[model samples]
Target: MAARVRRTTRHSSRFAAGSILIAAATFLPGAESAADAPGLEVPVDYTCRFPSGSHAMTAVITGSIPADGTAGRPVEPRDIALALELPAPAVAELAGLGAGSVSARADLTVVHTLGDETATANWSGLSASAQGITGQEQVTLHAEGSVPTATFGSAGTATLSASDLTLFLSPLQEDGSPTEPAAIEVECGLTDGSDGTLATVVVAEAEGEGEGEGAEAEPEKPVENGGTAEPEEAAPGAPRIEGRLPAGAREKLEAARQDVEALADGPDPCPFPPIPLPTPADTYVAGYTNVEKMDGAALLGPAHLNVTLMKEYIPDPCTSTFKVLSEAEFEYGGRRQLPPAQGTFLTYGFMPTTATMELIQVGGPAQIESVSVTSDPAMPEYTTVTAEFDLRIRDVEVNGVPLDVGAGCHTVKPIKQTLHAFGTGNPPSGYTVNRGGSMDGETYIPAFTGCGADEDVSSLLTSSISGGGNYIKITQAPLCVLNDTASVDCPAKKPTPER
Candidate 1:
């Protein structure tokens, strides 16, 4: 299958949580603002939850004023960014479980009231580290752009805003594996600050079904921590889960079980079954001839010869035209042989007269090759000839392997054939034909002829070829013919005297 083309969209990594924080702090408030007034400090907390009945985890981000303590006067709007890193194993596990590529979208919104109006921006499409996340991961958030002074009141008061972000988990591996998380970093500060702090989280351990449970399941040894009595063992004859079958059924079951046990213990010779081989030849016939000549005059012979043959014999001053139409049909017994390897079959049918000849090649291994044609002697339109070629194969094989030749086995490799045209006038450009003989003023012979001038002939060749074991029939009308004269010492049929 061809791979589908995907349109890629460009995204900004600068908006990545940490980068936003760094940029804001380094460029936001100037040196004057840092020394004049006390800056606002706000602490933010983040939490995440899984599906119902699952555990939830939270992380906190602490915000404070710079050492100068004067960075929050004449406040402007600020942009907050957050970055989360997850363990690699967790990411792989989730991916293995068939979660699609994971992406984060902000579900939280913050509202601030300045002196008069308010503004808002939706934060979405959070990016994560492409690698290194294996176990518990950490995420970072940055808030530095701007917040209304009225919303938070004073730097002493805490301005709280919560966002319920959704983490989309998608499988990254073809064979579903859970994704892993390594660590997360959150950065937050005033719109104008120098730099931001970096934090890290370490994954303690990983536990799941793939891990060995037996080794981890050691029995808790009794200790001096308020233990009372030792567990007593039950009597030897106490009822237990001995079996689940009744006495009579158990007897028969035991007998069958014994037979299976015997077979397993007694087998020495290889028990594999014999493999079947394909037949070399499905069917072969003795008499398969395509052409025969009689008394210097060619007639439709054995083998299928379905083609249009046109001949013109021009004596001293008179031109005599001859035309012959023929078709062949083979009644197959369904006992057909295919080659060792699967391949396309090309069958050719030839028809020739003393002056003209035509050859037609169709696809597939089937019965009929060509059919239905219309031709005329005068007003010849010989520019282009078109013909429909049909293909059919009763049976075929590839590499000695039998193929199912049906609608279901429609896959076919490309095939091409060069049709040879012999005995004719100049064929159209790109066509080669054998030319010979001379009579009257000019001599011309055409070997290859295609459909010309007739509706039935044109339609048949223009239609799409059908597949399957069905017969393929093509109709072609060749317009070019040879002009030649030969003397024969034979008497012409006498015309009866007019009464």
Candidate 2:
């Protein structure tokens, strides 16, 4: 059977937990401040470009922001509530999509400026619950979610302004299955050419640190840009860890040292650095996994490689826009075919059956929709990365019998598979571009089509395999950096198959 996938960059990253404080400036009427200090209403007009057309919307953002904050501490927007009024035409468009109800999530980028330095945070994950669309009148969506925090290590006046706004819409039928298009993404910006300044916060130094006159003047400190600074030396109270010597550890360390020294003398294989920019950088990815069959049988032989020898682009940090410079080149000059997976399992709960399957690439190379990198100001060394992609699967067999699932046999719709990875300083958690990791998600196996060479058996396969929530897990090794050998050596290793 073949499965086709669709990939798009919806929202980038999830906000890491930190301190709390959120406020907004008023550009429209009905802006009010609560007696409780930073609680207020921020009204602004936005122009959102939908697939149908552009429409005007009025959004009232309600949140808490402190008037004064301490430096060296993180400040997160708290109790964020967004009340967006949708135009009638927008409602009609949803009705046209066969949507009885609609739900949405949104991301709004906030820019913070302190003196000449600037930082950014995403006020993301604002979600609105499902509500019926009558298509006769305007609809209102109330979205609320937590946002990422911003840290200021220096004392100054930090200005917060709104930048880009992205909306992800999910339309569903009465039975709860998604509509034909499934999801819709919309891009929005301020209606007028004005900087949507939400609020102004006065940042003061932390308590108990002061300088009196006649004391020697301290050196000028560097301005911070949403990141914290590490101390020059370890704290006296902090514990130090020392590992006991292990046998052969010294010899292994020496061998690794010699290999590094040899690479220093060798010519640099990569001509360019892997930086986040408009320019695309190509890297090779090799992955392996043990696919769990519907019969509770695990395909263990030949190692079901989800993606082998596939090329991907380095994600741009500032924005979510990217272009594929060119199609990936495999050893055969095109798509790389995975070796057929062979395994034996109980066919019908008791009958042991042997099967071989090939995972054919449905489209071209998997599309790298978006890449999001988030670092904690408290622990700057530890960072998290999230990436999304689209791929397809094809071909199946049982007892050496060809299922004959034609080329069109695939998932009825696109399913999203998200993978995450961590940085070097952090412990291994998820899939990272530099160090390969594991990815697990549920995918629906649609009913088989064009089966049976001698007699039709598509119904038998469909009855056994077609359904939602088929679990799949894939592990990837460090990518072979084709353009940057110093970072990652060429000829990436194939990961041992993971459940």
Candidate 3:
């Protein structure tokens, strides 16, 4: 049997760079950015485990991908390849085993980041042709193949970085027969503290969309009344809407929308076929609700939410709603994984069954808009939050009979709600953003649309479930500090309805 053992150490091993090498690149000052250059050149260090021992290898990856692409369009990278230089010691050992030639196949993982949203994809099926091995001279393996394409859903600057490379080596005799060891699998990880950036691309809005028409409009000066000033007329050359957006609010709104959308994806983690346990989060914010319908049936939920705090841009001028703070300057973005809720309720006093509802946030994350602090005992200290969402009734069952609601069954308009929280203990029972507490709001459910897959059931649902005066009671749990074990419950508990 072949002696089986593995060892690892840091060593200055070199790699023959190629278009698709598994490595990070070095960028020189004054050089063209990846967007302007013909291709990217990056150097990466990796630690690989072999039967004899572990070796550290440095490699340079060179490849070409379009510097700019339209949102919702796929961008393909070209001339992707990999080159590896095996140390002479490892080559000699392979030759000693009666193997005359060797070949390899590799796969790599790539990460794409747009704002705070991140997605990972794999680049697989690259191969290096077999080459003869002799004496103690170093051996070189070259690999190249088709790579996956990346598609961005929104407009922004997206960065693509590479990590985690796996290689499969096959040893064979001169006649191409497998050697005694057959094949070897080597797992390699980027060296600690090494960057594996592949490329950065700028994504623009799709065709026929007017996204940057009035880029020069500045926000109106703050007013003494604390309300937003009436918007002035647009400059002669700018597109005229009802009003112009603040100087940079358009850009901020785009980014905020992308960030909120990232968090709003996927099913709710609180119910049915339990989800994986939560990971340690540095911060946590949740919304638990018991929403009562017009007919008294209720929906219970705790939509777990997280946000990226301390962002520097305000995202309101693009909205039709009036601004609360005449001089609001910053905004925070929520993280992805917004939960879709599932619950069962009694309909019309007798029918009992389950329903799957998707709460789609209409615009973006809740906006704080403004905050006020006061030393005078009578002048209250408070902050207001505004958010809008469409309650989509996707699946329903009455008396265990599945209602054929079409995919688009949802409220005709988004349900707009405003919430308030006291920063100080003014009410002693009110919510504080940082500490979490109770919040209540009322929603007007408009008629449902696009209901009924086989037969039109839109009227049936609208008449029985839709109306004004739907009450929503929510309780937010304290922020979970992921790093502080004492302060957080990893994978937060399912929220309990407040009232």
136-158: candidate 2 lDDT, tens digit per residue: 47778888865544445456687
Give the deviation of candidate 1 from the true structure as CA RMSD.
38.7
For model 2, the stretches where C-alpha displacement exceeds 4 angstroms are 1-36, 208-499
The CA root-mean-square deviation of candidate 3, after full C-alpha superposition on the true structure, stands at 25.8
lDDT of 2: 0.49
Candidate 1 segments exceeding 4 Å error:
1-54, 62-95, 98-107, 113-126, 133-160, 166-171, 174-499
How does each model score on lDDT? Answer: 0.23, 0.49, 0.54
Q: Rank order by lDDT, top first?
A: 3, 2, 1
Minimum summed lDDT over a 10-residue window in model 2 is located at 238-247
For candidate 3, write residues 1-499 as lDDT tens digits: 1111111110011111111111111221222223444866777788888777888875566678778876655566766777777767668768877888887767777767665445555565466777788554778787776555555555678888878887777777777666777667778899999898888888787677666432343344354433234235434222111101112223433444454345346443222232233332322233433333423334344455553322322322222111123111112235232356566655664566567776666676666543322332322234456777777887787777888798888888887766544433322223444445545556677788888899888888787777766655555654554556443232233333333
Better of 1 and 2 by TM-score: 2
Cα deviation at 301, candidate 3, in Å, is 49
Which ten-residue region of model 3 has the weakest summed lDDT?
10-19
**TM-scores, each model vs. reference:** 0.21, 0.43, 0.36
